[model samples]
Target: MTALIEAESVKRYYSNASWLQRLLFLGGSEIQAVDGVTLRIEKGEIVGLVGESGCGKTTLGWLLAGLEQPTEGAVRFKGRSLGNIDAETRKKVQLLFQYPRESLNPRHNVRTILSYPIRKMGHTATADITARIHSLLEAVGLSARYADRYSFQLSGGELQRVALARTLALEPEFIVCDEPTSAVDMNVKVQILKLLSDISREKGISLLFISHDLSAVRFIADRICVMYLGKIVEQAPAQQLFDHPCHPYTMALLDAIADIDPNAIRKASLHGQPPSPMAPPAGCRFHPRCAYTEQVGTICWERGPALQPLSTDHLVRCFLYPEVSQDPDRKQ
Candidate 1:
């Protein structure tokens, strides 16, 4: 399948200071929310982006959704540049925020909420608009009867379904789902995920599923990208990443999830929090916390490793592998 969305060396930075205080502070440090990241999503495929909090996952999603433009690179959709697309064309891509309740307008009834997008898209007839609203509600597992009820009357899951219905009203070809299941209960989460999967398969909609939940990503995504400090450390097929993670950071994360063996000695966990993106480490950003840093040496500290091909599709950015095999421990 052709790539429906592609980001090349995308970067986004924020200079932090409230508008009221900006005049007092002459120079505030810039936060590198997303730095030099590249990714591609094929039509009808689900690509999961997994990382810890403050790792730039949400920023990347925003860039792809066109909610925020990249500071550096470009986001392309269906072979056309996002920067060049007209407003109508851009509407083909939608973003579903993490919290459905907070995202919805409290004052509007569900019918008004769902119909708002349709009306904005310029469908004037009341009969046509009502039919579209009903179809969208039914598609997202909500009844048309609930359309007259306000957001406060709905449960968390129901609110989320309404949000989904609203998004579907635009008939978007691609969506950036930023932690869509994070706020709901497990049962509700399962329902949402299943609904998203069914919609994608049936309609051929592409998805960028961003979440901190590795297990959830494994079930939803065909390919996975592991990110650290605004960079993609590893990209592989979902099963390959879970079965054999190459980057030290990726290994540490997987180890953190596994049940600890009672009889075995406890190994040291990854040390130190991620370095500030304002002044990220000179070499490999993860070397400071990596247990395998002994093999990294001066080169790993002096230069960053590029994403090297490990297999047909899997790629990693660490010195332990053959193309970047400067690590003495891996050599031995």
Candidate 2:
């Protein structure tokens, strides 16, 4: 099966410019927001990206959605490069940002928000456009009465639902959900997840769900990928990953969610906070904090590890797991 969206060695860097740059020629350092992230989302599949706050999961999501161009490599949709796709074709992939309250226009009513996307269908009667918006509201579990309501009039969950309604209005083939449930309460979070899962299955729309909540991702994603310091550290079938995490970082994430399953792993604290991407560690980005890294030698401290297959459908990047290392003489 062909991938609905493919990102190859994608990297995104943001340069910092100080006030002195306006006067002098010196430029500030570049922040490595995303570094060498390659991923594929198969048609009709939901892939979850879970990671620390600054690990570039959201940046990768936006890169795959074509909202931002990579500093290197390319993002392709259905074998066609993102740059070659026209506006109409580009609409096939959409991005739902982390916060709906900020993502949605505060001034626009629900009718105006949804109707904006239908305008791409070319000029249509105002009544027909409104009718379409009403259907979208209903589809997102909102009543037609919502059409007259402004974003401020709704709660966080309600606003997110309205945002989802606007997204569905475009009839997109793929959606990148960046922590869509983060702002809502626990009860509402489950409802939102189910709604998204149901909508994906019903519409056959593939989804890239990015979140820090492993349990939620495992519940909603067909496959799960773990990111660390701007790189994907591990990936596998959701159940497989939750059952047997390969990378130390993946294990730490699982351990962090100890409340979910008492027997999963003891509530262990990680060594320290992740290093800044602007000046990442010399070797494996997680080496400074990974307990297993000490089991290995300089190999884990001198060079970064590439993602290697652990099983037929599982991949992990780490030096402790020497069986998957490409370097034949790599330190044990």
Span of ten consecutive residues with least summed lDDT in model 2: 323-332
Please identify model 2 stretches exceeding 4 Å from their true place. Answer: 17-27, 260-268, 323-332
lDDT of 2 by residue, 50-111 (tens): 99899899889989888889998899999899978988889988988789999988888887
Report the error of model 2 at residue 94, Å: 0.6
Clashing pairs in 1: none
Q: Who wins the TM-score comparison?
A: 2
TM-score of each model, paired residue for residue: 0.90, 0.92
Q: Write the per-residue lDDT of candidate 1 for residues 259-315, one digit (tens) a residue.
A: 767565435456668888888888887877877778756667777778777988898
Give candidates' CA RMSD values in order. Answer: 4.3, 3.1
How far off is residue 329 in model 2, in Å? 18
